[model samples]
Target: MAQTPQQRRANERFAKNEAAKRGRGSTIKPKQVTKSPVSAGWVVVLAFVVCGGLLLELLRIVPELWTSIAAMLSRLTG
Candidate 1:
């Protein structure tokens, strides 16, 4: 379907108005946003806390396990 002459003129007027607005710098440039380094730091801190807790749990369990194994070994050998 072809646009009528009136529709064509109206489209041209809209395009020209848009161009004029841009030429006059009616729009502002958006500011560059900076992300905080604190989020990365928090991630590292959380990893350390979780790993430390796991290590502590293992440390608590391993000695008791070792003693039990050693006693069984001694009884078997004796």
Candidate 2:
């Protein structure tokens, strides 16, 4: 059987009252302070190492990219 609109409204009002009653007992817990496992100097060093590796890889690929571009241009012109 289907419920009438009045029954649905009664259920909504009952839920709202129950939720408001439960909301009054809430307390906030203090947040804990934590320290980093690695030092700041190590983090900076790791960043530089990663950047240097990327730079080296880019330098190695640039010449091959230029060669590929040249090949494409030659094919287009021919």
The model with the greatest lDDT is 2
**Cα-based lDDT at residue 61, candidate 1:** 100
Local distance difference test, per candidate? Answer: 0.95, 0.97
lDDT of 1 by residue, 1-78 (tens): 999999999999999999988789566789999988679889999999999999999999999999999999999999
Instruction: Point out the worst 10-residue segment of candidate 1 by lDDT.
Output: 20-29
lDDT digits (tens) for residues 18-70 of candidate 2: 99989888788899989999999999999999999999999999999999999
lDDT of 2 at 14: 97
Model 2 misplaced stretches (Cα beyond 4 Å): 1-31
Task: For model 2, give the RMSD to the true fold.
Answer: 6.9
**What are the models' TM-scores?**
0.48, 0.56
Reference-based lDDT, residue 32, model 2: 91
